[model samples]
Target: MSNNPIPIVDFAPFLDGSAKQQTADQLLGSFKSYGFLYLTNFGISNEEVQEMFDLSKRFFALPHESKMLAPYPEARTHHRGYSFPGREKLPDAGDVAEMPLPSVKETFDIGREDDDSMLNVWPPDHILPGFKELCLAFYWKCHEVEKNILRALALGFGLEEEWLVRHHRMPDNNLRLQHYPSIPLESVLTKKVARISNHTDYASLTVLFQDNVGGLEAEDPNEPGRYLAVSPIPNSVVVNAADFLRRWSNDVIRSPMHGVRAPQDMVTEDGMLPDRYSIPYFCAADFSTVVDTIPGTWSADYPKKYEPMSVGKYMLKRLADGY
Candidate 1:
């Protein structure tokens, strides 16, 4: 595995503000160097994290037909909604045609659950009581964790604690619930390439809450032949920066590219049932925000390196291909 290893930052102090500046300094080092980290010790509780994972398991357990009722094709939510395993594509890949075999997975892409404007398409009330409420709570909690990390990131960058976060007000965000069907050791896995293949997320940072069973890998850019397994650190949110952030940082940080290959034990509800779950929260700037050069982030020699981009358009395009 190449790319200098992704750093690790202990957030326990940042959450409590003990040696606050010190914590911020640690954050700066990781973001500036690798743009990815395994953050152990934050304010979010294990029970809360478990609750979110459980909710996702329940949601993804529904019959395939039942989950398909809420497609985003006509909803016009910038193409956001419940996505079947094969319906979505990674924007960077550009291989949108159907594959001989479909993805052995299912998912629900959700954002700000409590915000009235961002309502999720639900299975009828009779089918699931209190489901939406639970998801909303999870979203809110993840948002809290995300904010704490962002503040730490801002301070690490030698800026006001709130400097980086303010741009995310009414943030561009999504909480995804993924269920990778378990496969047998001997069987060749089946997969369909979506147009948005193998790409880095475009958000400022992504927080992944993974289960003990691991498959998440970061492609080693320096040595494409190998992959570094991102081992699950119980209760820790695995955060990584996107291309936009690396560009904003004037290439100081690395925007990694990764993907989910077939899991080893995915039965219908293996990850969605009594056990197995991996949930990730992606955070982005509000669509209206300008994602040009990050303020005070450039020098005369590196003056404003990027063209201005509408937060929504840049991301919408990424999502169109994959995010």
Candidate 2:
């Protein structure tokens, strides 16, 4: 219903030893409140982000037949490759009947290439000269950033700095390139389809590089039915806590529901909206890692809300439920 009041924090201090406690405090505060924030000076260059977006555009521009080379469901098992529009439906987190429309976005997913069990699906090198290399590079850079953020978050949670880093040694992270195609206003009003339906991310943390055509909205903690628009900030990555982390903290931190919808002013003279692109790096703990409440985060008054489970099992179940 309004713009987000999430704080923008400079991450440069976290890299150096100076003012680290202050940085941790800011992170903790933001996590406790909105569960989202804009992170700047996190070290990935702007040019690199732009290049990744360019490659994503090219990939999405491929002919339908070509893009379908690596389709969903089949790729869903491997957790990689293309997903056409309408291929995904974000089932209401609370009730399925609340919003039955399928999400109206196309996506391409990739993971660490070194993983033998879940290999990345890439376009032929000849078709997109350096696509694979650039994507992999961006993915690794995001992974490093996630690690550093986790280090700061560990301190915020009153734990050893390396507590989270040690548990995420073999992360099951994914790099998802999403494209929400233009649509008519009438269609949106009639069908009630969202670019992406409202839901909390299944990972521990999500680092997103969104374009200026913003539609991202985060639910307000203090007001039900009220949402806050999260506009894109130049040279910044939007970071948010996810369900896994909330579970790990026994709800000490929140993983608020977020979604995408076309902004009112997005319509052009022809009544067609501009395509929106976003690349979100889902930072997850290792598949085999069993997630439980952190030491200082739980008490007898507030018992652990989640049963212990492996990250892999939880992620697969969530993915299956989403489709």
Candidate 3:
């Protein structure tokens, strides 16, 4: 067994079909124990990942006015555009209607091309040539990898491999690019705000790719209030279970709470923390699909812990609560 609390799983075995069952068994254990893992060999090349990062840096470097051309909607439900730092609020100290922390990060959220419920916001070709085309292509590529993981999860649950994949057929997911710029170390030390406050995701699952400047941490399962740093491994993606999956599994797989904090050792001589960047793909289910405990996940020993709920309703409520 690895000394690291979170295991690293190679996805090649699952895709090749040679050791699919063995791969699924390891995945099942990770989800049940840590609710998170580092996944490698799931497709997508390092060059492609770096290109996305380069695009993000260029986009964020633009003048504030120019970047704001594609504005975030006033309605939280319509989440497809650029959000300036501190624009989003998330619960950190408590679970309440009003979240207490204003994250010190800027974000650009992209949804599926065919999502008719809300229009996508993007910079014109003149501003960034081929930006939309590249992002869209990358979005679908990530989805292909997502489907494979869903299939693995289904197989682990003793259901058809396509079971979870079918539920997420609709294009209702989010691809977010985040930039946490350098900030004074005093602000972090005083607990005035965070790069991203401690909170669990609202989606079914999240696949995260982060740069070398690492500060992401998962709440230690063995210690309630403490956290364990999740260092960045080159070319690895961090995968974690989220709220909707927790509900669907009837608490069989809990969503791990996580957040990012500035590393003290990396503090600059000028008392500033270095900038950090990350890309997270939030995978969700079809809006109208009703989420209930998966088959074989509950019984007399563990009855269904949640009521049936539609993904749309659940997502809206969670988004509203965060704001």
> Which candidate has the highest TM-score of all?
3
Q: Looking at candidate 2, what is the lDDT of residue 192? A: 64
Per candidate, the number of residue pairs that clash is 15, 1, 0
The lDDT of each candidate is: 0.67, 0.85, 0.87
lDDT at 255, model 1: 82
What would the per-residue lDDT of candidate 1 be over residues 1-323, giving only the tens digit for each residue?
Answer: 24437667788888777777898787767666555678888777899888777777777777777677765444434444567665554433313363333334567777774455556666666555787677767877788887887788777777888987888888568887777654442332323332123557776788888887766667665676465667676667788888777776767667877665444444344333123467878888777787667666788876866778787777766765432
Give the per-residue lDDT of model 2 (tens digit) for 1-323: 14458789899998887888789889978998889999999989999999999999999999988887776546455668888898788865444578657788999998988898787777677776888788888988998999999889899888899999987888689999999998876776565676776789997999999999998988889986677889988999999999988888888888999888668787888877789999999998898878777878878887778788898898878877776
TM-score list, all predictions: 0.83, 0.95, 0.96
Candidate 1 similarity to native, TM-score = 0.83
C-alpha displacement of 199 in model 2, angstroms? 0.8
Pick out the ten consecutive residues of candidate 2 with the lowest summed lDDT: 91-100
The alpha-carbon deviation from the true structure for residue 166 of candidate 2, after best TM-score superposition, in angstroms, is 1.1
Which is the better candidate, 2 or 3, if ranked by lDDT?
Answer: 3
User: Tens digit of lDDT per residue, candidate 3, span 1-323?
Assistant: 24568889999999999899889888877988889999999888999999999988988888999889999989878888899998887777434554477889999989887788867899877988888888888888889989999999998998999999989998688998899999998997676877888889988899999999889988888888888788898888999999899889988886988989888888999999998999999999999888778999889988988888999999988877765
User: Which runs of model 2 end up more than 4 angstroms from their true locations?
Assistant: 1-3, 73-75, 92-95
Best by lDDT: 3
Ordered from best to worst TM-score, the candidate numbers read 3, 2, 1
